[model samples]
Target chain A: MNNEKKKITMMFILIATLLFGLVPFILLTKRSGELQTGNMLGILVVIIIALLAAVIGVKRIKDLKQGQPVEDELSKKVLNVAGARSFYMSLYWLLAIMLLQPVIADILFDSEMLDAEQALGGGITGMAIIWFLNWLYYQKKGVN
Target chain B: MKNKIKELRARYNLTQEDLAKKTGVRRETIVFLEKGKYNPSLKLAHDVAKVLKTSIEELFLFD
Candidate 1:
């Protein structure tokens, strides 16, 4: 498919994912108070996917409007650098979370944390946020 | 790296969009190239040089 067509399809998929994946996950989380490990992980995963889709969808729209290709060499390079940086950052983030799990659980959950699953979910969410932020930064600042 | 993309583009009566279209890249890539903020791949450099009617070595000066 052409870039425009691919982008349009992606936009549709983004909308569908948000409507089905994110909304249902939110509803499920609300229905289940003091979320189970699986529930928390599910919600975080959906949120990360939604966030990434939203970013890419917005970028594609802008590119289409400007008559630019949805994916270009510069964008690819920036994405690679951002992904590498975020992956490295996530390792430290997870390690820090693991070390401070007790305090974090006390502060955030106000109860005993069940296991590493919740921390893992939180770590994954953090990683996604970091990746998104890094991507935006590199896009604006330009990669060497 | 510094490049004469902006100068050469203007000499060729090409806007950033025009150059981008000819080279098959986004206008932002052209802007970045002109600003010397991006290092293009060999293929992109060659493409841009061709569009600007110059050699890659003459277009890009590496310090």
Candidate 2:
């Protein structure tokens, strides 16, 4: 694989891993009276990691942009196709979540209806996961 | 999309940075166009092509 692809994939791996790693901490923060200085430190660390990941991700993306002389028709097609696929997939997720909100609220966890904050936290995290997964997957595999 | 931006920029000997500066876009957008990983908006396509002294059709090719 080319250096550009490698860098991008590495960035994705970093981001996905960070997301997965932070989930538990973020979950802990959702519980009332569970907050602590350590939790604050953890959040701070996660933010720092995310910032670093963004820098690397942006660099990798920028690196791809540096290849203008040979940029060609196939590249555009690949971009558009992948973009469209990611778009549709994420849109479907958005719609599905909207449609299933009540059922998901009822079936998944008992507190979903009572604790609006936790429910929203979980929902946001879930959606973000889906979004990032789609982008990473499409970027890696190309569009179907 | 196939672009003659490179060739035209070369004709004028404008670097990607120069073209990007002139076009009010990021150097990355210029790079993306060059790499064909980005398809610019019609307005952008026209603007770049015009600045480079080419037609949009000549600058972009349909798959």
**Candidate 2 lDDT (Cα, whole model)?**
0.63
* Model 1 CAPRI quality: high
Q: Write the per-residue lDDT of candidate 1 for residues A12-47, one digit (tens) a residue.
A: 776686658667666766786755655667576766
Q: What share of the true interface contacts does each candidate keep?
A: 0.71, 0.00
Best by TM-score: 1
Q: Single out the weakest 10-residue window by summed lDDT for candidate 1 chain A.
A: A33-42
lDDT of 1 by residue, B31-62 (tens): 89999999999999999999888999999997
- The C-alpha local distance difference test score for the whole of candidate 1 amounts to 0.83
**What i-RMS does each candidate reach, in Å?**
0.6, 9.0
- Pairs that collide in candidate 2 are A68-B34, A71-B34, A71-B35
- TM-score for chain B of all predictions: 0.97, 0.90
TM-score of chain B of 2: 0.90
Best by lDDT: 1
